[model samples]
Target: MFSKILVANRGEIAIRVFRACREMGIATVAVYSETDRDALHPKMADEAYNLGDGPAADNYLNIEKILQVAKESGAEAIHPGYGFLAENAPFARACDEAGVVFIGPPASAIDAMGSKTRARELMKEAGVPIVPGTTEAVDTVEDAMRIAKDEIGFPVAVKASGGGGGKGFRVALTEDELQGAFEGASREGEKFFSDPTVYLERYLPNPRHVEVQVLADKHGNVIHLGERDCSIQRRHQKVIEEAPAPEWVVDEETRERIGKIGVDAAKAVDYVGAGTIEGLFSSDTNEYFFLEMNTRVQVEHCVTEMVTGIDIVKQGIKAAAGEELDYQQEDVVLRGHAIECRINAENAARNFAPAPGKVGSYKEPTGPGVRVDSGLEAGGEVSPMYDPMVSKLIVWDADREQATKRMIRALDEYLIEGLTTLIPFHKTLLQTEEWAKGDTCKELLEDKEWLKSTAPAEAPKPVVEDEDEETAESKYLVEVSGKRFDVRVVGPALSAGVVAAPANGAAPAAGGGRKPKRGERKGGAAGGPDLVESPLQGNMWKVLVEQGQSVEEGQLICIIEAMKMENEITAPKAGVVEELHVKEGEPIQTGAPIAKIVAAAAE
Candidate 1:
């Protein structure tokens, strides 16, 4: 085992790795960006280093700086955690060449599965079940159309070859939509993964997203833990995940088959350490198709751990240290059902808009069968520069039904003030009949009814009475130890009277602020009807409109990148652009002016 390990990630995952290292008696090093100086992960690590001040590319994704920190901190291993450089092959190779173990699969395994197109080809060659699609990257719209129409037929998926997690993925049902989907997917692939390559696959409209968790050792021993059902999603991103996928949906026979297939996929790449093989399972035909492989511990790995009682991270580290598997396939026992709800700093009512700010008054749920993996506290800040996820609420029970109910109880008890969260959404999702049946509630999330109905609950207002009026009915009940006394107040009631503010300690009333002027908006310090203010805090990625350019209502004017997601700022009404206040690549806060728009003049 390594004496020290450096975690090359951020947020909850970083903290998770730190906790694992602590339990194993291994020192942990944390690297942070400028915005994350006060982040919980850094505060919890044995030692911390500042990678730099800027976006992820300049900080967390800076392989050289991370390697430098590892060497300086005297760390012998680097755990990528997940996301960012987790699946980057070159970074793994760099760690290997630097003589520091990368606590993940070898670089060769990552390279084999990093690209979706290449992975599909390898899987097919290895006799693993794969979806019908092109075996190579689709170059142009013509190629995509040919592949979709001639080979895979219509309703094909155009996905990024170099990434997963719903990024750079689009589905086109008709030939006319192929061109747009192809271009959009390619653009997103380049922007997110720095890879413009893409490939086509047969799109499954209602197939469930099921995945198998596999652990492999350097001694060529590979075994799968079990399957997790991650079908509940929004915008193709998983919102909830559970292990031992409902027996009614995936029977024992299917589970054993998929587990072996998972091991086969890992062995094909000579994989070592912890990894996940995602596949799309069809209920209609009882068939499953390979989706992609995650090369590190997953966000939903907690649920797998809950059921299997395996410390996957520790095993991964041991494997990296040239250790062999301690347990065989028969030794693995999956017990109760577990579910994980990803609680993100987002407003479900407003299209799940990212809500990044200081978390005030955070009260996590605690009870039997409940666990919270979070990096935030009462006063910690959730910045827009990283993922919007605040925490993960994982619950376990003897069965799926009990787990569902327990999850609802936990979600209801979890409280996070000063910022909107998905608690209400999770509560609503768990209560649904479809969810109770272990069915993917994708449609429920997309339904306007729930989206419009599940806003954060409002706090109740305290009653205020006039001090003068309270004098007529002033009564006080006083208690001393076990004794109680009733007394009538002669003047205004003490509770009714407001305390005078200290000379230098006066506080403002709630909702006390300068009101916007007529035709002015809520965003920006100074803004009129014409000012187009940013709705969220993020870095300006692109400005679509120029000065004096005419734009219609709801037209996209600019793009702001926040929380690794891009949000498009649109025009309020038809108008001519007046002035631009922000430039490309500049960081912007909520209510910051993006541009000014003047109503178009009538002829």
Candidate 2:
């Protein structure tokens, strides 16, 4: 085993690798960018090195800098934990040239399966069931259009040659949309992968994403763990995954067959370490077609680990060390069922936008059969410089039904305040009949009703306002932690209040004047209470209540835009709108006052 290994990634995955290395008595060296100086992974590792600036181009993706850090730290191996450089064949070859082991598949294997176009060709040659498409990248829009019109036909997918995770992909259903789709796909491909190459494929309207996990060694021994059903997705990204795919959908016989094909695919490339063979399964015809092979540890590998009772990371390291396979085909066993829900810092109701912000209150659920792999804590800052995946919630049970129930219970226990989360969205999916029956496909999110009804309902409106009622008895007073504050009632009853210290250490009154006492207002006047302020930094996307408007308890005040998506900011309590501090186009930082609501005076 290597004395020390350098983790060339960030976020939860880096922390995950660090934990595995620690358990194996192998010291870990973490590399971080400027923005991640205070990241959780760096704090967890034994030693950490600053790579460069915050930007990926300058730091995490800088091959020379990463190699330099590994050499300087005397690391015997480098583990690229998915994303960034995990599947970069050139990076693997560089490690070979630098006399350092890359803790993944060999460079040759990576090259063989790295390019979707090339992988399809190789899989076809190896007798694997491949999707019908162009074997090579189409160089021009004209060629793509011609192929779509003549060969692959309409309703085809134009995908980037070097794309994964839904980037650089477009679907065109008609001739008019082909040229635009081709140009958009090419532009995204060039910008993201520096490759303007794309190819066409026959689009399967509704298909379930199933992947087989396989492990190989230098001695040509290859074995598959099991299959994971990742049919629940949004915007081409998987939101939920499960192992031992519901027995009804993929029975024992089909599992064995798929496992063999997965192992064969790995052997075809002389693969090493952990990898996944992704496929698209159509229930209409019960036909499966090869999609692509992920050449590194996947984001949802925990599901496989739960069912196989195998430590994939440990195996990855051992395989890279030239160890022979410890388990054969017969040795592998599928235990109970497992499921994983990716908890991202995004809002599901508002188009699943990224909602990055400081975590004011962070609580993770724990119990039997529940596992949380996280890299965040209370007071931790979720930066927009990286993926919005805050953590992964995994659950295991004796069967798929129990696992699904446990997952739903776990999500309810999980709480993350001050920023929006996809928790509600995940909760709805867990209870859906389709999900419970294992009838979901990749097009699960295409349902408009599911998207609209999943979110919590809007709050009720407050009572009507009286413009001429500016009497002392009409004012209301609120107390927070024994400090009395005064506020005016514009429309209805409000219970929430915000405190901001004055310049001279004196407390501000209802209207920014001298502080008032309980039951006392300005000049002994009476009015309603104040409104709650946003607890995080974001942009106000929607104004739920206007000036002098009434609002009820838990009413959605506005949709705050943070990270990349919108988060519905709700009213803390019932009240009438007294003041509006933020507009739709205005940007608000953390703890910035957004609005104030005045509640009715006490009887």
Candidate-wise lDDT, in order: 0.87, 0.82
- Any runs in candidate 1 off by more than 4 Å, and if so which? 459-532, 547-554, 570-583, 593-603
lDDT of 1: 0.87
TM for every model, in the order presented, reads: 0.86, 0.77
> When superposed on Cα atoms, how far off is each prediction in RMSD?
11.3, 13.3
- Residues 1-603 of candidate 2 have per-residue lDDT tens digits of 799999999889999999999998999999998788767889999998887674688999999999999888999999999999999999999999999999999898898887889999899899999888899999998998888888989898999988888777888988898887788678668766788899999988778888999999888889899899998887678899999788877878788878888987898898999999999987667777889999999999999999888989889989998988678878889998999999887656656656676676789999999999998887676786677888999999999989989999999899776666778888888887788788774345776666766664442121222433333213456787998756433333223363444434654456533334434632312223464666556667668689888888888788775654335688878878778888886777655667787784676
**Candidate 2 residue runs with Cα over 4 Å from true position:** 441-444, 456-603
Worst 10 residues of 1 by lDDT: 459-468
Looking at model 1, residue 417 earns an lDDT score of 78
Candidate 1 contains a number of clashing pairs equal to: 0
